[model samples]
Target: MNKIQQFWSDFCIVTHKEGIEYKDAFQFGTSADWLADLVVEGKKTATTSGYMFYEFENEAIPQTGEYYIVLNGLEEPVAVIQIQSVEVIPMNEVTEEFALAEGEGDYQFWWNAHEKFFTELLKEYDKEFSPNMLVVCERFKKVYSK
Candidate 1:
């Protein structure tokens, strides 16, 4: 089996969960090494994404209770996580507690970094950034990691 399939097999055996398939598998950010490290260290438990990006890619909104495989920079599976919560709110409406859960520093840091990152991502698609734009905030639990 490939790495991810083997990882999934191992996870099933260890967790004794049946009839559950991962909803998605992906890296946290453009570069996942540092973020993956944070996750492995139990620092990052939440993430945010622009709603427009999801629309741009025609992807469904993340739902709670869904499992996912977290990948690193090398596109190798590193951890398994389950979505604890998902919310769609305006970017300006994000809470300090939620930002802190992201493990990226304080709210100011989260705002500055996310604004910059989303600004660039929107620009690439000829979309404009707005504070009122929708943001998908997802909180997940690191069930297993290496």
Candidate 2:
């Protein structure tokens, strides 16, 4: 089996969730190594992404109670997370507390970083970033890690 499959199998076995048949593994924006490190250290607990990206890719919006395996830049599974909450709101509407949960820095840092990231990502698709654009805000708990 590939590394992600093996990691998922082992995680299920240890967590007593073998009956679950769904597995969604992904890395954080651009890559996953730095974000994975933050997560492993319990510094990062939440993230936000532009809703247009999901619609552009024809992917379903993230929902609460879903579980996902967090992969690193090398594509190795490093952590498992369970979604605790989900909110779809305007990018400019995010609360300071939620931004802080991202563990990147303070509210201003989060705002500046996200604005820039979204702007660049949208550009690649010939789209434009707007402060009023919808963003999927997710809060998750680290359930298991290796």
Candidate 3:
């Protein structure tokens, strides 16, 4: 296993001893480390993506009660987070409350950032961007960080 996988394993053992269970591991953002730090600092409690579930049917949606190992840009496990809730809304319908929960910035800032992100992301599938596209919004709580 790699350092991250090993760290995740060790983390699981530690949490298991504390009666907490973790489900999977993943990283945030594409090329930056900021999001991981935000999560570790308890500043960011939510995230959203336009990656459609039907397009990637094998990937499981973030479900409430599941824990995830958050990895930084270096792929090192930085923290563990327990999913609190999840919802799907159109890109244009994301509420300011949810945007604030992202802890990135104001609603317009959140919208602009996500717009650029999803626009580039859709290119992977040769797809085009749409303001009405569905986005999966997830809220989570920090459980542990290393």
* Model 1 spans > 4 angstroms off: none
Q: Note the Cα lDDT for every prediction shown.
A: 0.91, 0.90, 0.83
Ranking by lDDT: 1, 2, 3
Per-residue CA lDDT of model 1 for 2-115, tens digit only, reads: 999888878888899866799878999766988888888899999999998889999999999999999999989989999999999999999999999999899999999999
* Cα displacement (Å) at residue 140, model 1: 0.7
TM-score, model 3 to reference: 0.86
Compute the lDDT for candidate 1: 0.91
Cα lDDT for residue 75, model 3?
Answer: 76
True-structure lDDT of candidate 3: 0.83
lDDT of 3 by residue, 21-135 (tens): 5677778777447888899899999999775844656677778988888888877788888899988889899899999999889999999888898889788878888999999
Ranking by TM-score: 1, 2, 3
Models 1 onward score TM values of 0.96, 0.95, 0.86
- lDDT per residue (tens digit) for residues 18-68 in model 2: 977544898988647999998889999999999988999999987888889
What candidate 2 gets wrong by more than 4 Å, as runs, is: none
Clashes of each: 0, 0, 0
Clashing pairs in 3: none
